[model samples]
Target chain A: MSAKIMGFDAYNFNFFWLMLLTAIEVGVVAQSENMAWATLIFVLVSIGVVKFIGIAAVFMHLRFSPDSNVLTATALFPVIFIVLLVLMVGLTSPSAVENLPAFCRPGYYGL
Target chain B: MSDDHGYHHGPHEWSHGAPHNSWAPIIISIGSGVFLFFFAKAFTMNEGMNGYIYDSAPLPLAIAGLAIIFAGLISWWKQDFSFDGSYEPQATHGSTPFSNVDIRKVGMWVFLMSEMMIFSSLFATYIRYRTSIDSCYSLEGTVVEPGTACWLPASYFIAKGGEHAHSTLGFMPDALVPGAINTFALIISSYTIVMALKTAKRTDLEHAERSIKVRNYLGATFCLATLFLVMKMIEWFIGFHIGPFEAPSLLSDQFTIHNDAYTYNYGHGAEAGAMTVDIRMAASIFYLTTGTHGVHVFAGIVGLGYMVVKAHKGGYGPGNSVSIEYFGLYWHFVDLAWVAVFPAFYLY
Candidate 1:
């Protein structure tokens, strides 16, 4: 059975909706002032991840491709990179963290 | 039947035709090598290197390399299009992982994968710096150095009207209007390109009236991509004050640069002091990431311009739509890269 949401083509409509949703999410994140820094960061990062995957799956047609191995391998790079980033940040000594790149320093959490 | 143009008679002859001599690949490789060598050399050179002046020392080599590279590209393109049947899609090896894919499509995919690595490294660097910096500059211009347990108060980073609290690491504009509009433009352009590919595939070039539809769609895609660039340039001019102009632009009033320290005022009036931060690393990362993406966008526009010209001549059809699909993959990848970049640089 063909999957259609809101009477639109599954692929094209999904992309359009995701784009709108992301824009809305960005607007909310930018305008809302009450959210905690950690919450704001989490929301923005989650939205970015979703948007990236959505574009790759639908727009790039990786979701429907027969060779999932190659597509998945390529997709794993970003995940691995992010994980490495988190590990690096978490494991670094406090003194060492002070010497990390300017934006990576502890002082610029939500800026 | 055997022919003079290197055709041979055999049971496996259909798959084993004699290879024709082509200089395009070698010329392009040589040109690209020369360009990259000089380009890297020039970029990496510092002051007082080998007793040579740093500013103008590599100019000649770089220019010559660039000229040769362009010449090679133009010649290669001309050579490819010279033959009548040159546009025909090639057969792929049936035993390979890419058996069902067009060779050009596979090539484009591989190229994009490499590009992903390039952006990955840039983003990784940005994230590393963003998460590790330990110093917080308060609105009152107090530097909170890293202690055994360094922490910032909530008021130091909150976004306020007209003026928000700045962090020592870096500060992005809180408005998000320019970024949101640019995002929408790029996403819409992706849709238009997909539509262009669909129209091109359905087009019957034998009928002049039907062919025009393909051209129109491609033209629209071109215009939309151009619009994305225009919007981005406008945003940069206003937000970063990057373009050439004497008059003060928007956001210019918010930024204050003193020595190596940069301060951003997030609150209104003189009551809220600016958030002072080290500007060098933050500015460098910002420019490097966004600048690299903009270069990719510019390159896509140039490629789209070529495709539009070819579409006008009825160069694409159902049998030869692989080129359009290839271009679509690249264009979409560009959009995908922007997806990550917007949030990283603007919203976050």
Candidate 2:
């Protein structure tokens, strides 16, 4: 199905924005000295997220098709696992085992 | 079950009543098991032993397993090649969420979910190391002794143009050229794949013209995918010199996985010369993430090669265009991955 976004061809619209975001991503890094890195990082991450959504929604047909909702749900099913992994990573990420939270440490429960 | 259940079978169509009939899956499993077993036997390394143990005896067996795997892959490809979307199996009408949807489409989404988990773990590993390790630069002039392990992001060599830095382009570093090109290549390739899918579904064009257009678009995608890998190699190993400008590859700049003793200059003054630091962690993550993506790109090139030939033979048309859509999902996912990787590993 042919899709449109703001009166522009959906694919073309997404492509245009992806390119612009990428240019800005590079430009932001290139001019890192002129701006706070935190601001630059925020901009980079914002652009990345937008480009990602645009590609997934329009190009990958995660938004337009009839089964889009179900398929998108299928695609996102692993997100829970991903979130769990991230949380787990935070616990064990430090170099020392002793640095881990008490519950994560062995013999903490006094088996 | 009916004979036309639309499940892929072996060399020829199978008898309907005879279930679990395909030999491809069994053969592939055996081949993979044998390959891994022999390959592991071929190169054994033990920490408590005398270095690496090399045995050429298992090498032949490993090659044989590879040959068997190739045979099974051919069988699988043949089964798919026979499909033309005429009999696309859809879920039966029911109360289920996926009822009436193309089964293959649902299957593809399920497959993408697994892929998402794989990349997610990679990202997790990257994040953990990044948050834990102190940056080598941040350790400069500190009490933290030289040769201490630290994270030195790839962007140092890339976006920032480390040590012997140069910039031919006014916008970005010379070292960042390959990465920048790769980003654009992936984006363009993503668009081309979409165009291929769009053109495949076109009813207006003449059959021959449409076939040629689909083939060309697929060919373009294949070329771009190949170009991304080539640029990756250029960035990783073969530094480039373009007339008045020169950019050292990560290897040439000593930003390598084996770089346990990398020199990090504190500043310009004579007293603040440099300190040796271990940056293997950052390099490892960089290679693992980008290399994983590179492997995906390479796999896409192979798939696109087949698609190009198939489209040239008029294997795709308005009726069979779902083939392009399935592959398009994969290609777009690859681009989506780079959307995260480029900024995280290259720009940041």
Candidate 3:
């Protein structure tokens, strides 16, 4: 995007953050024995979201570009569907995994 | 409608300007449908009401479908190969929100939106199973019978190191080495591809020098993507050893889609409490999700391959660099997908 962040190139800045966050992600998982599993998961997910935003916003030029808004909205158009899919399958059904159709389960299609 | 260029039969013609109507899309769809139908038939040809037998009688028809698909692809590429960014395809005539934007860029985003749906559905399935089933570790001391299906996350084998966990890397398990390296490789490749686009758009540099720089950057990106897939193979099938370093592949660790009776050691040495479990679901989803990501990487590798060849031929420059920008969009999306996948699949 040719934009700058903290006087550094935006892509480089975002790249640096992505790498550091990924290292922390791996480090947290490696140190699982020393921390609570819940904490580890939280950290992993938090870093994951940040890294996702970083890649999408900076690397993908969804920020600092003239077309960012329209394109970002275009990219996010599937969020509602994704949330609905997760909600229907994850929260609404307590036994969604168990009730999964035979064809959809593992070893059914032999993939 | 131009009289000079009668049709899109030549590589020198611009695509968006002509009244171009091609059968490639329909041909591809027909080929895909034929391939899928025959592929299904191939697997079921030997099935009978009385019993079961293996059969692949329809395989040739499926291969023929593949041939058709390839033909369609060649038709599409031959038309697109000569595009030098002379005409930017934009939705300018419409009152739609995407007016004045490159239609190719919009198409890319829309395509990525659909991809988001696919991946989100996959993640939904992962979450569904991750929550619905009891983890194998949680059932270590339970009264559950053997052969019960349970979640034994790939992270157990990768991040925590299952039965064959080794500390050769000192900080992380040896198995984590491949995934960790792949993560960085993708991130670095993201940078390199951007550099390629930047170099392609440079106006001051000599044509030879700019083309050389762009080709190098793209070539570096291609190498990194190849490295990512190679590491995936090594982590999934070929266990490796380097002096004091050793990491077992998932296959070597008995994690596969067909594994219905996996031997899960409960972190106890040679104990009677060890139990047999059906870890096929976890293994399947692991492969399904990461395998899907791997497919995307492989696809990127193919695209990068073409781009490297094009750059080598000095086919990119300030006027045509939008190709690299569009490609960078896809490449960054791949990196973004891995951002979620590496943590969810390999770390957590």
Candidate 4:
């Protein structure tokens, strides 16, 4: 008989699926060179999902735990930190000057 | 398995609370922090690439930190706390073992938290580049202006020919394909580790002894991690093929320093000059972030070897397999981080 869902080793199972999804997302990103930025964003979010699943199901040990608050903080804090950090970095960086005629040539703009 | 004194307070007794309370880790942390501070100052100060003069302090500080941490661990070894740190029954009675797990796991979680921040910063930098052809196009949402001077320094250097002029708009290096292959390798390793964990949890000890599956899993993870590093080195070598094409642009510090643009407005029969592809910033940061992760993978390889040795020594099983499981968690964490990193930095 299959193991009971309630008693299933959710840590291992979720990690397995998360890794598989991560592999698939990597393939998608690899092959989607011609895809739109919006579609790329979608792929990124999928990657983010896999990341969350790994963190939630394993590192925080949420699958076996009874407390959701601990899990929520554990999972949410890194994300909040990432968002805040990205925002801070974005705000501090000088906006790229798009008006220069030399901007688009490969080696003209430092980027 | 959840016995409070046995699992939690056991290691505390092993070290007798004496060795574990040393100031070594704090000193090590501070030393490294100070080194990083000075290192940043060295860069901002523009200390003229004199590495022998400037890098001396940071290197020593890092070495001192390593020495301190290693000494502390060495001193703490083979003591009462060596066996089971949490459950020191005779001394510190009624101190629940749950308290130990709480702190220990929380610390690991926090360390991983810092790791996330580090990688994210790199990813954010990459996103800025992937979205824009140039700084102007990046901000103003306007189409890239045509006929900018293309610097082909790298091509000139590598091709051993007179400067060939071409447009820079459509230049791309083929780094993504091998990177993608490495990505798959890590994924496969993660699966193998999970399989190992599964085998460890099974009831048959004799079968587990004979199977050698966990050993194989750990070995595979090590191989894949090494493969990723090798491929990354190859990618850097490929960047060298473009000569000055890999140099950063002179226009900005945030971007790669590509050669200075010299405009030539020859009318009618003028062909567009060859614009070099500057892969320096992209390739450098790519290596830094991913390379650091690769070092961590190497460390994990060592950790896995330790785990395998201990497993052979019969230190882990279904009843007391938390150590192996924690290692598994860390391995998977590394894999998950790469899933985002690969696309964000390379494919996108």
Among these predictions, the greatest DockQ belongs to 2
Model 2 steric clash pairs: none
Candidates, ranked, TM-score = 3, 2, 1, 4
Each model's TM-score for chain A is 0.57, 0.79, 0.81, 0.56
lDDT of 3: 0.82
What's the candidate order when arranged by decreasing lDDT? 3, 2, 1, 4
- lDDT against the true structure, per candidate, is 0.58, 0.82, 0.82, 0.51
lDDT, candidate 1, A1-111, per-residue tens = 123557776557866777776766656655546677566767877777787777777667676556545655655555665567556643354545456545556557665
What DockQ does model 3 achieve? 0.43
True contacts kept of each: 0.23, 0.69, 0.71, 0.16
Candidate 3 local Cα displacement, residue A16, angstroms: 1.8
DockQ, all candidates in order: 0.26, 0.45, 0.43, 0.19
Of the two candidates 1 and 4, the one with more favorable lDDT, higher being better, is: 1
Q: What DockQ would you assign to candidate 4?
A: 0.19
Better-scoring candidate (lDDT), 1 or 2: 2
TM-score (2 decimals) of chain A in model 2: 0.79
Q: Which tens-of-lDDT digit does each residue in B215-289 have in candidate 1? A: 787788788778777766654455423332122222253221111344444344666555544444444566678
- Measured with C-alpha atoms, the lDDT of residue B150 in candidate 2 is 91
